[model samples]
Structures are given as structure tokens and as C-alpha cells.
Target: MGKREQAREEAAFMRGDVGVDGAATEEKQDAAEVERGKAREALLRGKAYLGREFLTWLLWRSESGEPVAAFEKTGLSVLFLGRVVLKGISGDVTELSARGAMAPYSEQVRQGMDRGLLVHQARLMLTHGEKAYEVTLDAEFLDIRAAKLPALMSEEDDSRTGERLYLAEQLSAMITTLVEAFIAVRAGRTWSKQVVPAMKEWMRGEEGTRKQTALQRAASARKR
Candidate 1:
């Protein structure tokens, strides 16, 4: 769980938002609902920076080609594609987006990462077995705004609906597992000792990129 959520739940517990035998009261339930509501609100309103952090971590992990989990025997892999929305924590150009096929790997997106911008929204292509599921993932809600399910082998309409539902459940399980992996690292001692350092190093590569670019320019000029 994220710090903000942990804090909120703790606050509720502190305030005794519990009923008989320490059961969650209406207020506590409302608090939980509030979180989901905020996620939905992110669609039209403010971004969820906490969730954005998770997405940013996922982006790095994905690019590093690290596997999050071994889902069943089929194996699940994630790739970000098409578009990525990034938002600055607190600075100029608070929000920016890159689109098209190569957007995820563009320099503008990397610069945004260098500027401490976390992912606000992104398109994910999850490959399970031999099929792929495409979805627009919202950072705050972890909601699937839209999805293109993998092709179904079912022939009848009802069978196709069941297949679709199964695919949706599979996607949800994949997301949950991915989030759990991030949470494990984040909640463990390795977060500050290892993960953060690794992420910072990933973010600190603009200098290298600039040097490479300069060398390319020099080589081009020499060719001229």
C-alpha cells in the first residue's frame, strides 16, 4: 500500500472509526470509498501522485526488461506503448504527454522523468501466453479506462462473453500481481537501499544522453 493510503487508514483507526468488535464503521467504509472516489475523480480532476510513483517504477522496470512475476505457466509480460502522460511534482510545465508509436521512448518523456515527473497515464500492452491485452491504465485508480481484450477462441455469443470476462479477470490479476511486486519492494528495506538508488540512476541519464548526442553531431560534422 502507498504511504498516503496507509496514513489515511491509520488515521481512521486512530479516530476509532470502528463499530462493534472493532469492525469497520460507516465512516471507515466511507474512507475506503473515498479512496476509490478519488481515483475516479482523477479522470476529470487532479492527478494521483502516489499512484503515479508506482507507475513510474513500473515504467522503469518494464524498460529494464525485468520480469515482475511468473503468472501461471503462460508467463505475463508488460510493455508500455503509444502514449505516456507525465506530470511534474512541483515546477514549470506541470504536465505533458507524448503520443504516437514511439512516445514511450522519446527524449521528451525521458526529460520529463529527469524533471521528476511521474507517469499520470499510460497505455500498456500485456502479453499473456500467446495473446496480448491492451489497456489504458490510469495511475490513480489503477482503473482500466479502455481495453482491447485478446482474441477469443469461443464461437457462440455467450461463450465469447464468458471469454471476455475471463480475459478481464486475467488482466486484473496481472495488474494486482504487478502492484504487489512493487509494494513488496517499496515496503521492504531494499526500497531506500536499492530501488530508489536504481531509479535515481535511471533518471540521471540525461547527461549521458546529451554527451552521446554531441558525439553524434561531431561525427556527422566530420563526415561533412
Candidate 2:
């Protein structure tokens, strides 16, 4: 079982209400739900690392050309554009930020990883057909602090307002869908068994060869 699942099970067991069928009692279940709700609230408040994990996984998938589990139907592709930030979560608290054309390929990112830093915020570009959306996604609360949506096509004031609202809703929905996809995978066995190992291997780049290899694999995967 993944760490998150194990943690939940252990928490339930600690409540001392396991039934003959090895199921939590109704009261225990209710308590567990309340705990889960609080955990969710904590994450939303940036008191947890789950948001950082999600952003890191998103970047890894984008770099490796792995298809998004939820956005397949939309034919949308996610790219890590310029302006990336990596922050140390423990001990000493270091912060590294990079921008410009070479930001994505900067050596500072790998160096930050070597020092136990994680992707704290990143600029992403999502493209679907002729429409391109650019946004800065924060790992703290999984919030989009800024976004550039496609130009509104409607000319009239009322129509333009409606179009703007529709675009905003669409953007929010897309972010929600992708985040849910990440959570589904993250809570599964495959995350610890497969995805995390690959991510670590990619992060420990030596002389840039490992990064190139990863990019090449991504390019090859895209061809198939």
C-alpha cells in the first residue's frame, strides 16, 4: 500500500474499533471522514506537501511526454514554460528561481534537487488546437496565481462578459481535472512502485546525460 493509504489505515486502527469483519465501526468511519476533511483543509492551507508532489509529478509527466490521465479526450498538451521555482521544504529552507529562455534547462534546477529542493511554482502552457493558455501554478495551494486566456471572440459587451466567464470556468475545470488525475495516480500503488523511482532517477542527473536521455525517451514516446 502507498504511504497515504497506510497512514489512513493506521489512523483508523488506532481508534480501537475494528470489527470481526476487519472493518471500521460506524463511529470510527465517521471520525475517519472528519479527519480526512481536516487533512484536505490543511492541504488547502499549504500545511502539507501533497500540492508540491502534484506539481512535481505534473512537470515530470510533461517532460517525459507521459499523457495526462484525465485530459486525453481534450487533446490538450501541457508544457513547462519559463519561470520555475524550487524550494527546500526542510532544514535551512533554500529557494531557487529561474526564468528566461533557458530556465527549463537550467543547471540550477538539478542543483536545487541535489540539495533537496522541490518544484514550488512553475509556469505552464497548455495548448489545445489554436488556443494556448499560459498560467503560473503554485505548489503551495495548487492555485493559479495568474493566467493568460485566449482572446475573447465576442464583440458586444454583454456577450464579451459571458465569454469571459465561460473561459474562466473552462480554465478552472481544466485545472481541477488535471489535479484530480494526479491525485488518483498518487494514491495508487503504481506511484511508489514505478513513478517515484523514475522521477528520482531523472532528478539525479550526471553531466546532463540523464536529462538528455529522459528527453530523448520522451521524444521517442511521442512518435509512438
Candidate 3:
């Protein structure tokens, strides 16, 4: 076979789109593509919890009144800001959003979390060492949206551009590291034995607060 013809056959083989003896491959290729797609769908559906849990855990940590995490011996600070979105795969109310300056620690966010919804997306203010970043984080895709980086220290055009790039890369790296840190802890036995239990305790506290708020509202209603 000539080089071009041989190349075409090899490419087709690599794609699993054809076989020897020139048998028709349309239906077979379509079946294979459908099977691959199904596998991908199943994988994503089953594994989506990891992202949700990581964001939820981060939000829980944020409520401790201070940034309370360290990575590779460096202190890191995370604050949920602007808007927080909580969602579950299946529910009567599948999604909820809390907004504004104090939205991160608001009663609605906590109550939603207590009800077993995970954080699907949230705005985050992150500090790594001395640098700060603001980003809206989407859990399922790990997307860093609407990012704000620290101010540049350079004035010259080339130098300023370089610094900006550096800051952007740093922002991305910090987020990736944070995700890796969460995954490590999640995979360890500590997640079940210690972490999850602690989170449940936090949730219980929220429930109590909600009950108290309900009582206050009822009392005020009666007075009115």
C-alpha cells in the first residue's frame, strides 16, 4: 500500500472504526461511541460528590472565624464571599443561593448544608502566604471563574505583563494545591473518623440555631 493509503488505514484502525476485509463500520463505530459515552456519563455521575464535599468542607472551615488551614508548611486563608450556591443531585429544591457581604456564613447557607445539600459553586477569597485572590469556584468542573489577583508591583509594560502572568499562574497553582489537599484528606481514614463527625456537629449547631430563630419569629408574630 502507498504511504497515504497505509496511513489512512492505520488511522482508522487506531480509531477502532474499521477492520480487515473492509467490513462496514458505521453501526459498529456508533455503538462503540455510545458505549464510551455511557461510561463517561456514569463515571462523572458517580464521582461528582468529591467536588461537592471539598467545597462544603472549605465553607465549614471558613466559619471558624479565621483561616485555619496550612499546606506544605505555609498558612492559607479561605473566605467564602459574595455568593454561595448549594445544590443536591436530587431534591424538591435542588439548588439555593445565598448572596451579599455576609452571605458566606448566613443562616440560609448553614441550614441548606444541614439538609445534606453540597456546595455546588461559591465565591472565595484566598490568601496564600502574602498574596490574595478572589475567585468564584465551581465544584463539579473545578473552574476558577471571575478571578481577581493581587495588585502588580511593576510599572513598565513588559515587566507589568510578566508580573500579571505570574500572579495568574500563582492563583491557579494555589487552587490546585488546595484541591489536592482536600482530596488527600478525603481519601484518608480521617475523613470518616474525624472530619465528617466534626462537620455533623457543626450541622447540629446550625439546626439548634434555626430552631431558636423559629421560636423568636413565632413569638414576634404573636406579639404583633
Candidate 4:
């Protein structure tokens, strides 16, 4: 074949129009891309549900007297603070916020859970070493909003800015680590078999545990 004709044929092959094998290669590539797209979509959907479930689990943990959860690797601890917001996932979309010592045990919180409401947001205090950060996290997107970081000890503007940035990044990393850990457990067998049942029991208030605990606290307060 002429050199120009040979070059054209090679280009056509590369374009997957000249041979069966070339066309098959193109088809394989297309299939791989589609698979990748599907995987990406599945990953995103998993993360969304994971976030929601994590929030619900956090609420359960708090009310069940395990509020001081830890990210052991990071030496960070999270305490669900006095404020929590639950939003209905279905029906009329009722929303409720509870505050103070009764927040976790509030009847509204229980009823909301019974009605298929998930924890939409929560206020938490995160402790790392001597510093503490207060942040409100949105469950659906895992967005941190209205965060209050510990004060920087530095007096100079540049130094203070650097310290603030460092603290913020550290807090962000802690939050990410905790969320990823929750997602891992939630996507595993333990979640459906153990965590979900525990959460359902808490929602049902099977033993009137929350109310009894609240009364005990009030009694203790009165004695003191």
C-alpha cells in the first residue's frame, strides 16, 4: 500500500473503524466506562445514606448514655451537645428540636423517630487535647456549619491565623475520620443485624429508660 494510504488505514484502526479487533477494543473501553460510572453513582448513594444513618446512630448513642464517642486514632472525642434537630423523612415532614438535659430523652424525639424521622442535624462539642470545637453538622450532606473553634493563643495576626487554620483542619479531619468509620460499619453486616435493632429498641422506648434517667438526674440535682 502507498505510505499515505497505510497511514490513513492505521488512523482508521486507531479510531476503531478499520477492523473487528479494534471495534471490540472500543466496545470494551465503552463498557468499562459505563461500569465506572455505575460504581461512582453507587458510591455517592451509599455515602448519602451512610450520613443519614450515622446521624441516627449518633442520636441513639447519645440517648443511650454513650454520648462521648471517640475517634481513637485521632485522639478526638465527640459529645452530642444539648441541642439536636430531627426532621421527618416522610409524611408531612415534621421538624423538632430539643435542648437542655432533656433533649435526648424528649418525647418529641421519640415520637419523631417512631414516625420515621431521622436526625437531620446535631450540635456537638468535639474535644482534641486541650481544645474544644463546637459545630453543627448537617446529616444529608455532612456539612459543618456554625462552627466555633477554640481560641488561638497567639497574639500576632499571622500567627493567630495560622493557628486557627491548623485547628480547623484538625477538626475537619477528625470529623471525616469518624464519618468514614461509621460508613464502614454501616455498610457491613453488623449494621443491619445489630445496630438497626438497637436503634429500633431505643426508638421504641421499650423500658422507659430515658424518662427514668431524666427523673434520676432531677432527683440528684435536687439533693445537690
Question: What lDDT score belongs to each candidate, Candidate 1 first?
Answer: 0.71, 0.69, 0.71, 0.67
TM-score of 3: 0.68
Assess every candidate by TM-score.
0.69, 0.70, 0.68, 0.66
lDDT of 3 by residue, 65-101 (tens): 3555665578777777668888887768778988876
Model 3 clashing residue pairs (backbone): none
Write one digit per residue (lDDT tens) for candidate 2, span 1-224: 89999777777778766654668676534644565455456666785377777777777677644445445376556767668888775767578888864465456675676677888888876666566677898887878899988888999999999998887887777787777667667656577799887777666763244335334533443443
Clashing pairs in 1: none
lDDT of 4: 0.67
Question: After superposing candidate 4, which stretches have Cα over 4 Å from the reference?
Answer: 1-49, 63-75, 207-224
lDDT of 3 at 146: 86
Model 4 C-alpha lDDT per residue in residues 70-99, reported as the tens digit of each score: 554446555566688887646886677778
Clashes of 2: 0
Over all chains combined, what TM-score does candidate 2 have?
0.70
> Could you tell which candidate, 3 or 4, scores higher by TM-score?
3
Summed backbone clashes in each candidate are 0, 0, 0, 0
